[model samples]
Target: MSLDRHILSFLRALVSSRERKVATAGVVIGILYLLNWSQRKTSAKISLGHRSKKSNKGTVDLEFFKRIIELIKIVVPSWRSLEMFNLVLLSALLIARTLLSISISSVNGRIVKAIVTRDFNLFMKRIIQLAMFAIPASMVNSGLDYLNHKLAIQFRAKMAYYLNQKYLTGLIYYQMSNLDNRIANPDQRFTQDIDKWASCLSNLYSNITKPCLDIFLFSRKLSDLVGAEGPIFIIGWYFLSGIIIKFITPPFGLLTAQEQQNEGLYRACQSDLVNHSEEIAFYRGNDWEKRRINNTLDKIVKHINDILTKRFFMGTFDSMLVKYGATMTSYGVLGLPVFGPNREKYFARIGNDPSSITRDYIRNSSLLINLAKAIGRLVVSYKDLQSLAGYTTLIHEAKVVLEDLANGKYQRTMMEGAVYDQKSRGTYIIADYIKFENVPVVSPNGDLLIERLSFTIKPGMHTFIQGPNGCGKSSLFRILGELWPLFSGTVYKPPMEQLFYIPQRPYLPHGSLREQIIYPHSREQMEKLGYNDEYLENLMRIVRLEDIIEKRGGFEQVEDWNDTLSGGQKQKVAMCRLLYHKPKFAILDECTSAVSMDVEGSIYQHYKDNGITLITVSHRESLLKYHNHILKFDGEGGWNFYTILPDS
Candidate 1:
């Protein structure tokens, strides 16, 4: 065979075989690996630059602009449907206001003409026309403003609802807060920042649109009087002012975001002081706390001062340009006809009558000046425009962070942590067996806490999980609860509802005593479930919380339960909740630490009698009698599972 025929025969043979396909894939992967190795050997720095260059490219992409437009569309809904009737109504009012604005300008011009001509009849008629126009103009302006206020409230409510849905979905709040901590004071962003954004948006729509409309409408009138040169001069002035303002303006967006973060930090410090008042008071760290708070306050003040300083300079420049420069530019443009070739023609039209000619000149000059001033005011409000930009940028970034989290990018980061079971669904459920199959526990920062851990607790088999702090004891529970992602294995457990986790410090929401017991369920829900005072009284008696009902009046009374309940009392309430729900598996992390041994013992026995499997974590040797199995962590990635003997 010829060389070409031999090569063709080999190619056909390779295409025809399964093994050859596998070999082809291997070769391609090897080539890619070699290429990566070559790049690494040649220049690791340039290899790293590939990632950063991608990020830099994204910053200036159309997606960011599209996000902005989408956000604005969310804030200001279109008038396409019956649901947008309010916006349609608002638009009508805005159009009415625009018409009134034009009328007001025209009336001012007529009043000037009436004065210069000095016709008493014409002057009186013009005065009455001005009065009538002013009445409706003021009414329209106020009515439009009132309508805008309502629209703003509605818009804000809708936007807040959408953002709240995103922020609170799944474990989004927890992931954003604990796992990433990228968005600061998401609470304030939803409340204060959203409020500000709504207000800015309302004003921005009106301020930007109305000025542009007025400039266009008035410029036409000015053109009719002083030719196109008058409006051209004012437009040129605006362009010049925009250039100067853009150059002088600071990075207001970054500054505003920093200000918000500082505010959250300062507020957090104050909140900590309040929440841990007893701890701080016991330590007598009032002076230290004062200094810390003062330092935070100092930071807040410094940021505000920086903002104000920038604004001060901007204000000075804006005032000079708008107040004085606008007037001079207007007069300069108006005086062109008087000094130029048009002077002889302008006087000849009035037959050498200086008064009539001067009167016409005055009326036209005033009209031109007013037109210039309106446009100038828009240019001067550029600071507010910058501030609006700042708010939108922060909101957009937050939106991006939230979307990334929902897409599981943060949770699935290879070097950072575990790959979560993204397809897992359904609420908490406890099956007949709770099993871990070669599960490895890793921290959020990817440190191995436990490795290849396999264990199973069958029905009626109570287990005591023993480990030193930071040995992944509590973290193991987090993975089972699906709060933390699993590393390299599956944890076959019941759904969330059938598994209950009781932390050391129980969460006590402010409500009636009855609400505290059956919580995560409302009084209304309990009532619907056929629960009554007598039933609740029975549950409390079982948990030995009967005294609490007597001391706090009745179950109907509402108070700050966290403050009112003692540590032991809180734990007892949690037990009552546990017994009330009666889950198949309960993970108690030192939940009975505050309670007396007698009460703790009773609670454990009650769970055993109820056929609820217990996974308990505690330092006390007192809890051993209630369990059959022991899972001990060696403070390394090693764990041991053993049976608890009757004597030992």
Candidate 2:
């Protein structure tokens, strides 16, 4: 129920809200011009890339907010003659507007008639008009496009705002730290997934409006051309075309989706190649990486080849339909009308103007030819767009996955007014993140790290979990902190705000030294946290980082701290942050391996003095003396968590 509600909430956020429904109104405007593709006239317009006003474009840029005002002015009863004036203006524009729709059958007849009579001059004129018809159509299309675009942006921005709010709303992030297995990478969902969603939404909004416009406009044009006969012929042809399109469309859309997946996989491999570049170089694994990359490329190539083969065959068939459909329909439909029979035959006193017969013949024949080509091309283009939209649905699906992740997560309630204590079965607990029952974690790929385990921790407690490399020390820390979920277990934890976990290689966010320490806090928060200039300076001095503090501008924020700080400095910076946060509990995952033992011992002593519980991961016996509890993991598989006994 929560997940369903989350999805509903996400969709609601995407479609509209009270404050921004005005922008979503643009979607309604786009539908107005979406039907017809080709027009006979051209006008000034703004391209999406530039969005600047142009003299040649015919479409009006109806800013969403501006349109509301214009609408209000028209409908108001007290607005003297405003509505009347708008109607007059609209009517004038409609009457002045030149519409040109050339039917496929009519153009075919004209070409046949022209060819039969060898009247090349007349044929050329019709062809020229047909060529220029798209300009006006495009302008009207562009106007509608602008409206749809505004709506898409509004929807995207609104959804992004809401999704972010929900994802970052509470201690969901804290509880989720323990349940990583339950959730995928949230970052990927936020960045890549959101982009796909926006793009898909834009395309979907355009398509819904476009097809309805096409059906209405095309039906109208056909009806006007041949009266009863035209509508029947056009509708019948469309039905037949749709059936054929259904069969051909699926393969291309499927192929496109496969291509996307293959591409993403290839990119992921490349990323791994880049991330471990130093390792590969030092171990002479260049050849190995190269071979792996080549293998991936080869696999992708085969899939693409299969897709291309199907695409080419389908393209050939579609082209055949369009090319011959234009040629045959133009001759039979238009030529038969103009040059069917002599209308002035057996007329004795009729005005014998040969030019009259010729003019009528030319007009009827030529217009049919132009209309035929224009309408045929439009149908083909529409088919291509439809197929592409179908394929993009997968992209939309991927986007929704992220949206779901962002909204759906487990909520943790901290035990209020409660403190933790160390236990015999604890993996490592000098402080909070005490585990009562921990089941082994079995990944989908069948990798097992830890078995059923249990433990506890308390404030002001100092403990250490020691094991050989990769015996799951860090993994245990993660599970205890509730960042990595045990396949099955319940973990009791203090309020998240009261605890902090420090990694082996602490991450430096893109910010200054002070910002790094008080990370994710705003500029105003620095002062609120009792972090004055003198305090910052003294902290740096204590960490032996006075030179960097002085050099990098005190409290004046560096843009990128990761590149600026060295390994030792970053660790010390993390410690400084630990001191600053003054959390009751802290987890150190080999956090001081880079620093000297003297420095490490002093930091531990400082934490003890401050009455802060310290959980340290280190190989140094010198450090273990400070920790009263020893949770030792045997290198093979078994482990023991017990109080340290001082013995000879």
Candidate 3:
């Protein structure tokens, strides 16, 4: 027999006699028990797979819930907070909406009964009641949507605030980017992934919570109208169908995570192109970039197509069982009270009246339909939940890494044959003068550039450092600036505020020219220091950039200074910034490499006249006249420090 026919035959046999009814109930209970056991076993396996720290991307198991709970704490911090109030109000609204639905269903049956019996007055009364309900019904639905989106925005805001705090706190951003290898694109996680996670969380809350409330309320009302067995059979049928669908469902969570990863890669590729457009154009690497971009796109397309195929088949099966099959089951349940052998029991209340029978059937059928819809939504939420798990995994991984970095813990994939010196940790101290006592210059990736080095720059001592390329010149500055971790030996330096560093390629922020000159400072701070725009203008003249202020529309005008200024102009602007800060010591790492020779000489003389000691890194012999001492690296893990002869 076909499935529907078999189901009908079984339903008929179930209510035929007391003995058959008992036997059928036992069989159903046993089958449900077995299915429940099997489902638990499957869930256990899924949980085990997802709990694996190395491969825990897409699985929805206990670990997924754990991550969700942890993130929830961040989004909704306190019970008395606004988020909690909104949640409670939203829950109340959902409950009110469900109750309104039940009332509407009853009114619908009454209207149908009045029409069949030709009672115009009764029909009109029910119609007016429904019209009155329309206002609150609309309000409830609109409120749900408004509150859901508001909560999502709040969640996103809270999460972003917390993450930005961690990201910008004390060189964590630099350490995360340079010292960690776990998160490939933290930028994507911070912006896109967090937004998605917040939205999914808000929608999932309503989707799952409302359905659960519906199931409970609808099942109770259904039992009252159609006897206990009627609701039990329907609920049991849906339960079995849920188990079947769970087993056949695809790993959508894993697929979603993979899709997001590919998207991040593609975005990163485009960012790289933008950042290096000039270099790429000079090399004519357009074809190479296109191939790489297309490769990433292909991966995303393939992943989405795979998900679509699985969803198609899964949706087909889901509709067959949850929708049409439920309709068939409703017919059987409806007949149990009116047409079964126990019809005599309901005859007095229903009273052999066709109108009464029709009314009960309509009302009972509406309840069953609503119940089926609620259960169907619960089943469908499984897929959404899986997608949420994917987002949760991504966000949780990033949070873990940030926390690890904050705790001074890091993990990096070291270069081949690079030995990390675990026992030789360097010490840092604050002093009036700068000194490095047997400090090793080590790169972030465990490359030891200078095995041991000693140097000192006391007050009035202008020291010059020269090294071949990759001979730890930049590495030393990174260590001094606390961008890289100190690895070995004792290093003493003035407070960070007393030391200023100017790199070869200056970083011009997207702001007014004034902000560029006093970067790491605000316009208000510049004013409080007894300086004004005229003082800034004088600093500009000293760096031979006197015309740039008027050329770029004054100091208050904002532009992309990096693109607007020429290379030589950019270096001059950097020099102007150094002159503005006027720190006791300045580390000039090729900062004047792009300036004219005369301009560079005058810049060094200006620093000498101001009594700002300089630690200059340059290969230009012309700068040797301004420095009293030299620290030279030979590129073979060696260095020397000595006085520079006045003539040399």
Against the unseen true structure, what C-alpha lDDT does each candidate score? 0.74, 0.55, 0.86
Write model 3 residue lDDT over 1-648, tens digit each, in one string: 455676698778767868886777867985775565456445645654644446667678999999999999999999999999999999999999899989888888888899899999999999999899999999999999999999999989989999999999998998888878788888998999999989999999999999899989988998887778888888888898899888777677877887888899999999999999999999999999999989988988886886786677677668878998888888889987766556787888777888878888888888888888888898878989989999999989889999998888888766677656423468899998899998888877788888888988887788889889999988988988878778878889999989999988999999999999999999899999999999999999998899988877898999998889999999999999989998889999988888889999999899988979989999789898899998889999989999875421
Q: TM-score, each model?
A: 0.81, 0.66, 0.89
* 10 residues in a row with least lDDT, candidate 3: 44-53
* Global local distance difference test of model 1: 0.74
Per-structure clash totals for the candidates: 7, 33, 0
Local error of candidate 1 at 149, Å?
3.1
TM-score of 3: 0.89
Candidate structures ordered by lDDT, highest first:
3, 1, 2
- Model 1's TM-score against the true structure: 0.81
lDDT of 2: 0.55
Q: What's model 1's lDDT at 328?
A: 77
C-alpha root-mean-square deviation, each candidate: 19.3, 18.2, 5.9
lDDT tens digits, residues 1-648, model 1? 554575588779888978787978877985675465444333523543564453321232355356558786776566574327765665666667656665665666666767777878888987898799877778777877886677678667877887888888988777776555557567777787777767766776667666776687778877776678778988898788777766555545445656776887898789889988989999999999999999999999998896786566556657666666777788767775554446667667668765565655666665665566667767755655555665666677677778887886453333544433433322333465788887778656566777678888877778998988999998888878777655466677877778898999898898888888898897778889888888888888887889878889999889998889889999999999998888999999999999999888988998998988889999989999899889999997788999975421
